[model samples]
Target: MEDGKIKGKAMVLSGFDQEESAREALEQALKEAGLAREAIGIIVTTGNGRKAISFAKGDVTEARAAALGAVFLYPTARTVIDVGAEESRAIKCDATGKVLDFAVNEKCAAGSGAFTEAMARALEVPLEELGPLSLRATQTIPMNAQCAVFAESEVISLIHSKTEKADIARAVHDGLSSRVVAMVRRVGLNTELVLIGGVAHNPGFVESFKRTVGLDDVRTAAEPDFVGAIGAALAAAE
Candidate 1:
């Protein structure tokens, strides 16, 4: 995209093994885009695996990627909350997408997507069901554990007590939302907040997140999963 708009995009998860798989997936994406390696002028990578992406010319920090990507997707975006598999980030940025400040929570899975995955498994529901199930919750149930491992046990207890799955699901979303919002507040959350990352696909989490943060509206991309790569692509274009 150095002198052009994005012509193609693709994604394939390797489940944290290494960069080789990601590279293979990239090659596939490039193939789908009808381009060859020699057609590209530069390459940039981002995220934890960035250091291992041997073919890349350089890298960008995940915070910068998320911030810039949010602004690119939504120009009005002033704050971005990025939630990945193992961690979460809150980024404050200016109108031009320059990161002003940011905060992160990586000490535990409490605020991460892993937290929801674990609870979903415990509930014996498809992971995709968590959001909708929570939405149907007729009563509020607060979760007590911030540690995902311990929280899994608490979920079991809720099950043994015959608590409605919907209520339990909402409780789980509530717990994760609180932790994510804490990071957002630390970064001085303002109007035009955008939520990105794989977890953002969950409507339940989105609603819970907005309500917990006392916001009436939030922004998101149509296909947010590629925001980081898009940012890296933007860097390469520069």
Candidate 2:
């Protein structure tokens, strides 16, 4: 980020060596921006691997970073919901990105992107295609499993019962959304809901979450996955 706005962005997969991955991602970002390392100033890190980045000047909690990033992207955002591969969080904040309250579902894969990935595998569909496939669903088939392991089995059973893949996909997203909505409720839902994290890119989950929360105007940025990084940058700027 530059001049209080994003100038360039890059992403790399989190491999076994998190610090190495962070370095590679930073290098990519710098290369994309055509800047040398010395051109950069402060670095504030957030997320699960924040502590692994020894070069960072400071670190912030994931929830706080998410809140800051969401409010930065959408000034009116009062509630921030972030659903990643391993965890999902709901953060209540004001226009200034001050976190008032927060809740997280960290213990369950069923409430994270991992659940959708598992269901997608069970349906023999690629992860990226799952969302669009779910949009083709004609009806909502309630998914009973509350665990990812069992959810995969339940998806298989649906396949055996000749259920449409699109319906099954929708059911998977619905189940994930229900759990996310419950988490958001703990933090107190407010107007201008903003969704950040990799899962925000999933249209099926977005639609399901909007319906579950009874809000059609949920907001998201162009690159939802980078919100935490943007938040960290915002913190560094401060």
Candidate 3:
């Protein structure tokens, strides 16, 4: 960021080597901005591997970063839902972007992007195709498995029963959304709900979350995955 304005952005998948991925992403962003590493003022890191970033000037909680990022993008956003590969979180913040309350589903894969990935593989579909494919569903089917392991079994059973892949995919999203919505309820939903993190790219999960939360309008940034990084930068600026 330059003078509190976004100059460049980069999104790289978090690999087993968190520090390496972070460095790669930072380098990409610097290249995009045509800036040297020495030009950077301060570096703040957040998310699961924040502390692993050796060059970071500071680190902040994912919830705090998410709240700041959401409010920065959508000033009116009071509720923030960040769904990532390993965990999903719900944060309630005020107009000034102060986190008032928060909840996380760290223990459950059922509420995370990983669950969708597993389901997609079980259905023999690509990760990116799962969302669009689910849109063609003709009905809503219940997925009873709360565990990812058992959920895969349930999906295979449905497949054997001649159930449409679309319906099964929809059910997978619905099940995940149900878990996420329940976590959001702990923090309380507010107007101008903003969704961030990698999972925001999935239209199936977005649609299911909207339906489950009973909200027609859930806001998302153009590059939702960068929200947390933007928040970390904002924190660094301060």
Query: Which one wins on lDDT?
Result: 3
* lDDT of candidate 1 over 1-238, digit per residue (tens): 5354776777887666658777886788788779998898888898878888888899999999888777887888999889988889999999877899999988688889999999999999998999999999999888888899999999999999999999999999999999999888898879778889989988889879988998877776678788888888887787
Models 1 onward score TM values of 0.96, 0.97, 0.98
Query: lDDT by residue for model 2 over 1-238, one digit each (tens)?
Result: 8889776678998999988988899999999888888889987889889999988899999998998888888888899999998999999998899899999999779989999989899999999999999999999889999999999999999999999999999999999999999999998988778888999999999999989999867887678999899898999999
lDDT of each: 0.87, 0.91, 0.92
lDDT string for model 3 (21-94, tens) is 99999999999999999999999999999999998999999999999988988998999999999999999998
Ten contiguous residues minimizing lDDT sum, candidate 3: 216-225
In candidate 1, stretches whose alpha carbon ends up further than 4 angstroms from where it belongs are 2-4
Model 1 residue pairs with clashes: none
| Ranking, TM-score, top scorer first | 3, 2, 1
The TM-score of predicted model 2 comes to 0.97
- TM-score leader: 3
